[model samples]
Target: MQVYLVGGAVRDTLLHHPVVERDYVVVGATVKDMLDRGFRQVGKDFPVFLHPKTGEEYALARTERKAGQGYTGFVCEAGADVTLEEDLQRRDLTINAMAQDADGTIIDPYKGQQDLEARLLRHVSDAFVEDPLRVLRVARFAARYHQYGFDIAPQTLSLMRSISESGELAALSPERVWKETSRALMEPHPQVFFTVLRRAHAMQDWFAELEALWGVPNPARWHPEIDTGVHTMMVLEQSARLNATLPVRYAALVHDLGKGLTPPQHWPSHRGHEKSGLKAIKAFSDRLKVPNECRDLALLVGEFHTHVHKALQLKPATVLKVLNRCDAWRKPQRFEELLLACTADARGRTGFEQTPYPQAAFFRRALSAAAAVDVQQIIADGHQGKAIRDKLEQARIAAIAALNDAD
Candidate 1:
């Protein structure tokens, strides 16, 4: 059986983007042959193998059958026994299903090449809904593919809406959902996720709390972006342009998540929405299969936002005391995350503070100023805690704030 490169590697190569992962499909190969060749056998429900030489993944051409519902409903029989074309039919997206032969000729039985040329995202087969998990994949795909200006097929989007209403989406594992959402959030522009899911009516169910931000009013004079939802979209979009990682992007996307969940008041009373949002984010973290670092980061960002509003009113020492309690301020990177979130929040206004990003570098200056405070410094060294605290007293307020302006 001849093996060929497939999926993202091929798509990225075509797009001239950096290719990160490599997956392949083996045509005319069988499970026995793969095992005989020293490949590790995996996927009980779905057959797949790992190459011993490259340690890269290699799957044989096979088809799936619907045994239940959601993403796990089907089973696969892969190996040299199946044709290369058969494997392409099973992939989630057209752009991902296309294969490249050893000679560099693309083997696209599903017209994925055409779709790629047209900058469109299409499904491989009618069984697109055999597992509702694909709907999330599609939405995630839209989020990334938007950089290429692609559109989801109308019929495909209709299927996603139907699948969500059927409650099959609930059957999906939180980890899988989180995995997909996390990847999508990494895209340069994630609002495509909103555009597709919103049009398909799937957003209301998948992330109902966020849907509340759809038409929420902004202070207008400060926020032209309007409600918490529109601001969320802007936050996610701007995140792509920043020097942040996956966790920071996610925190930014959901930084104001609690604003919509706030109790209705004559005016938007974010009261304890920050704390409330933390609780919500934790539950969401559990569902999205977010890593501990990301979850903790998100929790800290939400918790920090809850307390940040009080920053302008507190003395730097008292502010330092409060900031010291947080794990975020413990790391320089995490500190930047808080600053980014605040900047994103500040940018949701109509005027100076209400744009998509901060103006005059306010958050950066605040972060630089915060860095001067010694509360997070190594306190005790070899000495005991109280002694360290006493020794640190020699450094006064004026002394520390001076360091902030030095740079």
Candidate 2:
């Protein structure tokens, strides 16, 4: 049996990128042949084996036939007769379809190298439309390689649009969708992932809340980028620029969902959108089965981002109230993430990209000052039960007031 390195390993190698993992496509191999060699079978739906020595995956060269609906609705053939070319043909993108031999000879049956050099993400074949997941995959690739100026080919984008309209995306599991989304959010240019999806009309299936933000208006004075959707993308971009955590990036993404719910008659003014967006955030998070960390942060950011933006003007009591409501005392890291998300929002507007966000530092100082209040001292001073709690609150508020005075 001839084993060849395949998929991401080969693609990344060609792009001068770090190869994190290596996978192999074994041609002229069967279950018996692999089992005789002591490889452990792992794939449930396809013939994938684990190398006994290296522990890397070794999948038998295989072909697939669309048998039903969605990405999993496929019958895979992994017999000894299956050619490496056939296995490559079944892949989603041309750049991902290339393979490399044991001798390091590059295989480019689908012109993956050419497309890679051109900085284009192109589909290997018309059969790319068979799997709805490719739409997300391509969008993710665009996000990952966007720093290198990579873009999806027009024909491939058209096919993605076709997949979006085919009702297939609805069949994808929420976990799978969220997996792609979360990974995309961490990419170098996460905003490109959503923009590519938006261009392909793919957001209506799962990201409708975000999609609805595109045409929504915002006050031009506050958001030089008057389009709420544009501002959100900018926020996501700024989050990435700040090297923010995944939860912070996610909060930046959904922080403005309430703005999309604004009545057009009120045009450019979303007075109560901060609280109005909490439900949409919950619904989006619940639908995607988002992790509690991400969902909770998004909810907090959605509800209090405006409060954070106006931090310098808020009274000390109000500052303490915001901190208490956000549970900053119990979960300081999430509160920090909330501040980062708000900072991203403040800088996301056009002509405000490099603008200062003193509010973030102000909130940080406020949290620090309030958290430094001597609860033990209050308890030592003969304050009992309810009185201790009240004293602690009063002391924290006083600490924050001192911070405000110093500022």
Estimate the TM-score of every prediction. 0.83, 0.98
Candidate 1 lDDT over residue span 1-407, tens digit each: 79899999998898777899999888887788888999997756656788899889987778877887778777767655677777788887788888898999988888887888888777787778788888877888788777777888877777778887888888888778777787787776777776677776776545776677776665655556657677778766666666568887888777766776765663454666677787778766666677887877777777776456445444545545544556334576776666676565555344534344432243345445655546546453454667656545434334434444453
The best candidate in terms of lDDT = 2
Per-residue error for 49 in candidate 1, Å, reads 2.4
In order, candidate lDDTs are 0.71, 0.93
Q: Mind sharing the TM-score for model 2? A: 0.98
Cα-based lDDT at residue 261, candidate 2: 93
Give me candidate 1's TM-score against the actual structure: 0.83
Clashes of each: 16, 0
Q: Model 2 over residues 106-171: C-alpha lDDT tens digits?
A: 988999999999999999999999999999999999999998889989999999999999999999
- Among these predictions, the greatest TM-score belongs to 2
- What lDDT score goes with residue 185 in model 2? 98
Minimum summed lDDT over a 10-residue window in model 2 is located at: 398-407
